[model samples]
Target chain A: MNTKELIKANNDKRKLLTKETQKYYEDMLIYIRLSYDKSEHETEEILTEMLDHLLEAQEDGKTAVDVFGENPKQYADDIIGELPKIVTKKRIKYMGMGILYFLAALAILSALFNVVEHYLLDLNELTYKIYLGTQIANLMIAIPIAFLQLIVILHYLRWETFKNINKVLAFFIYWIFGLTSIGLFFVIIYFMPSFGPLIEWNVWFNLIIGVVLYVLARSVKSFI
Target chain B: MSLRTQLLKGILEGCILAVIEKQVVYGYELSLKLQHFGLEVSEGSIYPVLLRLQKENLIKGKMKKSPSGPNRKYYYLTDEGQEALEDFRHNWEWVKQPVDQLLDRRDNL
Candidate 1:
């Protein structure tokens, strides 16, 4: 009740923290180590906080370890729960890159069909010239789109990016949509001389489809 | 003091320091010596602490490839660690004196 009693009580209680509590602190350090990679300062800060918690729990008689141990796998299960859905850093970036590649392939294939349609169908000279240009331009556009796709894939697979899924999604959405729209705009501009007013509608339609497809792909990647 | 348990640990540290001062020794052999001295520590606990201590510069470590399983890390005490062991020995002597006196006095009473 008095100061000496309190001091003795505190000292005695300190002895009660138990080996299990120390094990809990050790387990926490292991958790931090597994979740993070190669930052000594971060590791040290985490350890210090864990030690403080262990000391406090020793005094309080209620360690977090106690709560966790009541269910043997509960601690591991909680960490497993904390994990960002099964989506890996590689997979998310792959989704973004994969979608962009598919779009590029689609555009190329479409332009090819147009070329064949014009020549084989005996279309007018002006239309044939424009279709030929469309095929050439679509092939040209594919190069940069492919490179951007590779960059996104590399960035996504990097150790830092792999830890978080949302960042990968954000980067892919930004680049894939941006690049594909630009590619389509160029395609339209290249054909503007022949298609004239029809070119504007083509641009908007392609842009809308690209955006819709990107969103659907990202949503699916997050789940699957 | 619960540090009573830590006394054997102190001796283990000294033995490790002495051995490593001579040549690098792998974990399994080091653990075997400690167990031979009747310090029943687990293999897992020993290596992790050795790694941590090595990181702290109390010791130095390097890995050698093994034909089986993974490579093994061999740890040796640093000059700084030997100096630390001397300080630990001096402090431990003083700390033990009073505890010894207290135990002796209880029997006399």
Candidate 2:
């Protein structure tokens, strides 16, 4: 057959296979997504690859079960079960980095608060002591929130939607918006009159810490 | 999993590496070759093996344009894959005798 004819024939076969096996493909994809939290593109690629095999088998007069085996679900489970050890290792690594980001964020924020209280805020000794206690109280609330935010960001990064973008670029874009929103939040907190005395530090500790963490996070791109 | 499936799972990675070692092949062709070797592996099952091999740095896949079709992801063995195949060969040789002896004794029984 000519290339055109072959292409048309292959396309027709693929369409037919997709239509006939749509339900199985969808089910398998759902199972994979639920089990592994894989991206849609990933699941689709797998389904299409399997369909290619199914098409080849169909051409040979075999059914899906004949080609895939008696139990499709079991077949999928086996496939996932046999995933490379590197996948798990990488995930654990990401989790580790996520924890580090959480801790680094907390450290930087704590340092920022210390500089603000110690140098920036204008108050008497007693009020300053009160402010320090309040700052400690504020951290108790902020640290957990920061941790949760980092986790959400990490999870969002894993989504298939960002798969096409360069990892470093994607990470920067997400954090640029994230850190900006956070900066705005602090600005709002700074301006609140009823929120008690607040101070802003002019030193470069926060910037330095932020830059160091950003560089460290950017360098460890294996997990993302 | 059944014993047969378990055994197949154990060797499937080496088998796939061996197939890619012979020639650069895409997913469909690789599946066909596996079938030709009398392995009753499903087309779906081969992908996980391919993915895992790629992850382990044993194989590398590149998308090459096809004249009659869209880009096909073709796989080739990396140096690591070659080294892994060599290791599998050595390990298989070591295990083969005991396995053969066990099977022969079963046959005799």
Question: Fraction of true inter-chain Cα contacts (below 8 Å) kept per model?
Answer: 0.00, 0.57
DockQ of 2: 0.26
lDDT of 1 by residue, B33-71 (tens): 666767665432343345445656888765455445433
For candidate 1, the TM-score is 0.34
Chain B TM-score by candidate, in order shown = 0.66, 0.86
The residue ranges of model 1 lying beyond 4 angstroms of the native Cα positions read A1-33, A39-224, B1-19, B65-71, B105-109
Kindly report the docking quality category of candidate 2. Answer: acceptable
Q: lDDT tens string, model 1, A79-101?
A: 33333332365455655656655
The local distance difference test score of each candidate is 0.52, 0.65
DockQ of 1: 0.02
**lDDT score for residue A52 of model 1:** 36
Assess candidate 2 and give its TM-score to the true structure: 0.50
Q: lDDT per residue, candidate 2, A1-224, as tens digits?
A: 33344434444556676454645544554455454334333444455566666766677777776666667677777665644333565666566676556556765776667667667694223122234345545555555566566556544543433135787987788778688758854864475344445554333555576668756766665436
Best by TM-score: 2
